[model samples]
Target: MGRIVALDFGMKRTGMAHTDEMQLIASGLTTVATPELIPFLVDYLKTETVDVLVVGEPKQMDNSASESEELIQAFLKKLKAACPDLNVARQDERFTSKLAVQSMVASGMKKKKRQDKALVDEISAVLILQAYLDRKPFI
Candidate 1:
C-alpha cells in the first residue's frame, strides 16, 4: 500500500506528514517553504508511492470556508498541474493548530521551544493526517 500524505499549508511555510506504507501509523515529515512545496512533494513522491495527498481545509466556526481557502485553492491548481496523477483530498483542519499547541504543553515542552512555529506546523500536519485516518473507517 502507498502512504497517505498530509499537508498543512500556510502563507510562508507548509507542514508535511505521512502514514507508513501499511497506512497504519502517521508521523510528521517536515515543514518547508510554501514556494518550494510543489517541488518538495514531487521529490517525495519519487521515493515512495503515495496513494493520496490530503490538504488541510480550514473552516470557520459557522462552517463557512475561511479566507485562507483562496490561498489553498490557488495552491491546489498548481499541485494538480504539477502532479497530474497524484490523487488529492481535503480534510477539515478546524482546531488542529490549537490542538497541536495543547499537545506540546501537555508533553512538557519548554516554553521557548513550544513557541517554534515550524514545530507546531509539523505537529499540526500530523494531527490533520490522524484526523483523516480516524474518519476513514476502512483504512
Candidate 2:
C-alpha cells in the first residue's frame, strides 16, 4: 500500500502531513513556504509513493466556499497537471487553525511555541488527515 498525504495550503506557508503505508496513523510532516512547495513535494515523492492528496478546503459557517477556494482550486489544477496519476481530494477545514491553537495550549506548550503559525498549520494538516482517515475504510 502507498502512503497518503494531506496539505493545508496557504498564501504564505503550506502545511503537510502523511499517513504510514498501512494508513493507520497521521503525522505532521512539515510546513514549507508557498514558493518552495512544488520542489519540496517533488523531492519528497521521490522516496515516497503517495496514493492520494487531501487538501484542506476552507469554508464559511453557512457552508459557502471561502475566498481561498479559488486559490486552492488553481493549485489543485497545477498539482493534477504535475502528477496526473495522483488522486486529489478536499476536506472541510473550517476551524482547524483555532483548534490547533487550543490543542497546543491544552498540551501545555510554551506560549512562544503556541504562537508559531507554521507549527499550528502542520498540526491542522494532521487533524485534517485524521478526519479523512476516520471516514474511509481503506485507510
Give per-residue CA lDDT, model 2, range 61-135, as digits (tens): 999999989988888787777777878888888899999999999999999999899999999999899988988
Q: Count clashing pairs, candidate 1.
A: 0
- What is the total number of backbone clashes in candidate 2? 0
Model 2 segments more than 4 A misplaced: none
lDDT of 1 by residue, 55-138 (tens): 999999999999999999999999999999999989999999999999999999999999999999999999999999999878
Instruction: Please list the residue runs of candidate 1 whose C-alpha ends up more than 4 Å from where it truly belongs after superposition.
Output: none
Model 1 alpha-carbon miss at residue 105, Å: 0.5
Relative to the true structure, candidate 1 reaches a TM of 0.98
Please list the C-alpha lDDT of all candidates, in the order they appear.
0.95, 0.90
Location of the lowest summed lDDT over 10 successive residues in candidate 2? 130-139
Reference-based TM-score of each model: 0.98, 0.96
